[model samples]
Target: MRILSLILALSFFLSACETVKGVGRDVESAGEAMDDAIND
Candidate 1:
């Protein structure tokens, strides 16, 4: 039972990390697009 709980918690933490990374990439892309528009 403890092992299962540990596994669940680890999975949640990994998924949250991936979600944050994805959001960071999206924000970076948006910033680049805005920069391009301004430069053009």
Candidate 2:
């Protein structure tokens, strides 16, 4: 039972990390696009 709880927690942590990474990428892309528009 303890092992199953640990596994579930680990899975959630890893998925949260991935979600944050994806958000970071999206923000970066938006920044780049804005910069391009400003430069143009």
Q: How many clashing residue pairs appear in each of the predictions shown?
A: 0, 0
Model 2 vs truth, CA RMSD:
0.4
lDDT of 1 by residue, 10-37 (tens): 9999999999999999999999999999
lDDT of 2 at 26: 100
TM-score of every model versus the real structure: 0.92, 0.96
Instruction: Candidate 2: count the clashes.
Output: 0
For model 2, residues 1-40, the per-residue Cα lDDT tens digits are 9999999999999999999999999999999999999999
State candidate 2's TM-score: 0.96
Which regions in candidate 2 have their CA more than 4 angstroms from the true location?
none
Clashes of 1: 0
